[model samples]
Target: MKIRNLRLLPLLGLTSLISLNAAAVTVEHKPTDQIIIKFDNANVEGNSQARTLSTRLNKKLAFVRKTSQGSYVFRLPSRENFSSVKAYLKVLKAISGIKYAEADQMMFAINDLAVPPTEGIVGTKKPIYDLQWHYFEPVGGMNADGAWNQLDSSDSVVNVAVLDTGITAHPDLDANVIGGTDMITAQSISNDGDGRDADPSDPGDWVSRGECYLGSKASNSSWHGTHVSGTISAFTNNSAGVAGVGYNKINIVPVRILGKCGGYTSDIADAIVWAATGEDNPNKAQVINMSIGGAGSCNATYQQAIDTAVAAGTTIVVAAGNSDDDAGNYTPASCNNVISVASTNRAGGRAYYSNYGDVVDLAAPGGETSTGARNGVLSTLNEGTTVPAAPTYAYYQGTSMAAPHVAAVAGLLYVKKPSVTPTEVKTILTSTARAFPDSCVQCGSGILDAGAAIAALDGSVTPTEPAAPSNFTAIAGAGTVTLNWSDQSTNETGFYIEKRRKFSNQWGTYRSVVRAAADSTSYQDSVFGGTYQYRIRSQNSTGDSAWVVSGEVSVSRN
Candidate 1:
């Protein structure tokens, strides 16, 4: 029966193609200046009636096409007013057949924003605040001066989109905000008016409206969106609040999605699309930060929206999630196109609450809970109504805080190399990451190195050479033989060496030696004393190169 169904599909395809001739006619009639509207469900009976109603209201309304289910697509006049569009949708809603009508902006959800400490964590001895950054510095091929110097030319006018709760009116964020929109409703998402022009009243939290379920709610909260915005691009050298990642020159576009308990997937999707490419509205964002996510499979609508954003020249940075599960369980983070970031403690180990997986592109300083060691991330915070003093600076801890660091760095990179593609950005980030202990499998690329990423942007750093092996000799007096090798390089922080018996087709476990300088490289084996094969490679602050193999030596213990 399955085979027969497959056989009939081709015939059905042909029939559909044949009937598409008239459908193709509508494409030509679509207005170049008009925005596109797509209903969630076109098969609803009201949708068909809406199509007919559209024709009566204006001669400019022309039916464009229909989905396989018979939902109609119509093109509105280029000059149609916003009120008219709303009235038309209201008319359709009054009909029983229509489900939901939305402009093209309602498709993608924005990525949200991260660090921290203690035993049971990797790199526990190191300070959590700079662990990941320090780890990536050498591997990223950057020095202290190179890292700090790159910031000057990289953050002039970069734009980063904060897609979360609405950003409040804070002095630090005031200069950085470019523009934004509200996906939950047509009203402006900013606490201020349109285009970051004026301040608006913040409506704190809301009860679930049966439209979406975002889980629990916090009793006390300052505008999350505003705080996140300040962290990424707050005005630098400002006498008031804490400094931001990209200094004051970077621009932020806030797309509010999460409000009350949680946000709806539908609304979040729209924010993602609009934030990246400025659909329906005129605000085009260069980088999108999604600090919030839920458990569910990646939907087609969301994936399509992300693809559109990437094509339009935007870099999406997403949090791996606080659930502590592998990133595969998350949607946009797991999505192949975007950069998925995991959380690490200040000590440079995986954060307990951070999600892990091979899909994770990088790790940052996400704070941990067990050790009383707060990750202490510096960023802006809302002062609340009583305070009313612009956004204040504070230390936050979480994968949420860590994510913006990467986003801010990406923004700086964009400013330096505007021509860098999303893929190249990902490469620069991943390739320069620092490896962490016990993080070999979980951390994916390694800790994100801002300096290394920037240095590699223009190909200014020199690549490190691979380390050599030493002390090749067989044990005397026994059939079992032991061989030793010495470390041959200075910058080598770790050694990856492998050995295999002569007759065996596969090599034994590949050993990773850590923190070894040019002086140390020795391996002891208790196997046959005859001829044996060996291979060694060195990894350091720069990166690991190809393994240098030893000559096939013929030695006898007897």
Candidate 2:
């Protein structure tokens, strides 16, 4: 079952509802008390049969909850008894209502469970750098409804769990960051531990141990985790070095997975599970951002871990890789759950470095500077110094930077509408995006529309079902055909218009016009005249909107 992030408001006095102890406990060794069974849908006929089979299973084992659509929770007698459960499931398959079933393995928490600092005192300030050199720009989405104006009052604190290289304790991020653990070694991964007081020795960077033609050219301390964290929740609006997407209220839960070279797939999976629900952590985060990914097939271990995180009410936002190839090759991003984001340039076109496919959920502004591409984005960085002087701020380009924009927006949406599920948040962001030229088709759900998304929080313009485009009217004026028609009520962000000659029987090329809420119900088509056939389709946040056809509007050039 797919689970999206559900923002839950703070209860009046439930401050002590949960607590995480640092002392290691024998988690895996603990006797198994529950059994989670994931089944194949093809094995069962219908929901009625599934329910009947569930009842039969309950006769042999105590049932917990039907967590997802086809998954079930059961109380097991012991860990060793898991084999018996699997055997029974196989036997029951012949009983008409059963498919394959197996025992759910216990997963450890991936993060250190510790209470994060509450928003209050102002910390040391970092210095601001030149913006021209870097591509940093204020997020446009924050301008809607003056959301950024009330940065202090609104609970802008978002718990971003970074499953990447460990963050260095730089001056800019020191205050906002809590402690993290090293999943690779399964030991305390803090920069300073035991007697060692706050040592700034750990410079978090990617290193390649083996020799290759690429050599050490790629070997550089990116401080990637630190940079990504700052973008999402750096102490912004605080007269510091650089402003973050949000304000100072944001907190980061650092989960280190990537280190020298790329990290292991097993470690990544463990980190994701821990970050989302605090499965093994003492303190859990609300949102998890995965900026790193691999180009390979999806693994069963990772998929199961993702399922567990979603079941516990965590929203997983992943970056569409930088390969610039079909996104289907990427696993977790193409996985059933999680929100996959693509990169867009400032001109509102898809970045050449971004991966695209039917699986792409949405796109954001990933700055491009190498090829003279510009995308205005805002984020945080570390000033390498012990004394609080100027925090190192920079403008970075990558799907890495773009992912946080969506995460921050998600945080704001959570603050406004707490009931919205993760899936719903994905829906809102995708459906309400503003369509730019060469944008609708190349990018999944158009550009990220923070303003339109926030407007959706109050249910102003609700999304409708998908429908096809129909009917075409052509009005020739000023060397352009003014195309006008009634808007479709479902699955439409805008319309795609194409032109072709009647004799050739071949449709000329086409360009897309994003439908805006404020625009009148007409588009001026300037390129074509004489006899022509036109077709249009509706687009939504999920992908392309269905197409409705209007027979043909004959136009005579005046």
Candidate 3:
């Protein structure tokens, strides 16, 4: 498969959500009053069996519809209070085949990063690169130009799914955009007179005050999805408004999840599965970008969707949120096995508006709009959605902006190393992350280094069996059981040891003894009590190898 061309590098950057004091701007994601339940024993054996299960579920619940294999969406009658929703879920979960249940939560767009005096879109006079200083100047830029030396171009088939407001028609982005989904359900919010459809067109997400139950002030359409698309593959070197990170041939699969006010977790989750599993995803996305998020925990609904995406061999990249708080408080960003990116300014300092915490994987350029769009991240945009006018380019900020930079980078790496996995993507991105030009507490491993990451892939895949450690020996002394092993693999960077208590000829569950660094072969395993047997395996920068036994040894509390 033809991947991104390393020859024609350097075209774009990412944006970030603005951070603020908890009290200044309240952006909380309230859950919808519905539940998503998944049946454990459900063997999607076929629709015939699922239809039977659905029939049985509809009898007890107010409404039951088969969403996925064993999953169903149900709601209680209005007469019953929402408090009973939990009770109903508990009872449903207790059913023989039922596994788990949770609320159909809500997710919102990264609040407006910058809204400089609203002006109708205008014409482009100067070349796009002249305005996109982030791609050339070092300042707060991500040094993207430097990385293009090693990687830049992309394959046409490698799709990066942009899960946000639907994309708009733009001179630079139109060709790269494949058809996508409109996940908005509410007609009022959709403004498209339909629930969910194939048309991923953005019909002005403008909202009135109090429209969201949050009493939020009215806001105009941000054209966010279009901007993100521009960053990923805005027909590069087109002598147009701006160049995309993934130049010519690279394509985008716009999965519209957020609309009018925002979207529900259920819809967003479904989009992830569809994009990842290639259900309706014609382009076959290798990466998914969710530049929008709201404050919330990692609910089961979001968890299952993400897990499914990962299992489908797709890398999920999410913004760390614009709220200047711990990203841990957000869903998907806090979800397991995702590349949760934080925003960094041109100086590489954590963008003040960017949410930070250990939850962040690495930092990306989520520009500070305060400096104006010229200084902020630049991408594609549209002045009107309904009639589709003012197709121009602009700069925006927020972690929302920053995520696409990484998403585009993931595409670059995939082109270079197709065998790489989601976990490996995270590892390469983080391990190769350059030190922040400035301090960024909880800003993750480091600022994203696109060139370093591509160079680091080095075509290395996890070994089937790195040579096991030899001279494996364990001895007990002075309340401590020290273990030593001889390294045999020249390529290994570390080792993992497991231990089990020897109960006569039988042994108990094997627990991890230690995960030692490459520099250390000897480990001081403190004895808790009794005799124990140990085994170990080697690990490389890629992943772990097969296990090796250390025989048996004894130690006593006395």
Among these predicted structures, which one has the highest TM-score? 3
CA lDDT, candidate 1, residue 7: 8
Q: Which candidate is the best by lDDT?
A: 3
lDDT of 2: 0.51
Q: Could you tell me which 10 consecutive residues in candidate 1 have the lowest summed lDDT?
A: 18-27
Give model 1's TM-score versus the native structure: 0.57
Residue-level lDDT of model 2, residues 405-434, one tens digit each, is 777667667656655678788888888776
Clashes of 2: 35
lDDT scores for all predictions?
0.53, 0.51, 0.69
Candidate 2 positional error at 432, Å = 1.7
Off by over 4 Å in 2: 1-146, 149-156, 186-202, 206-218, 372-378, 382-391, 437-440, 460-558
CA RMSD of each candidate after superposition: 18.6, 18.1, 19.3
Q: By the TM-score metric, which is better: model 2 or model 3? A: 3
CA shift of 409, model 3, Å? 0.2
Question: Model 1 Cα displacement at 365 (Å)?
Answer: 1.5
TM-score of each: 0.57, 0.54, 0.70
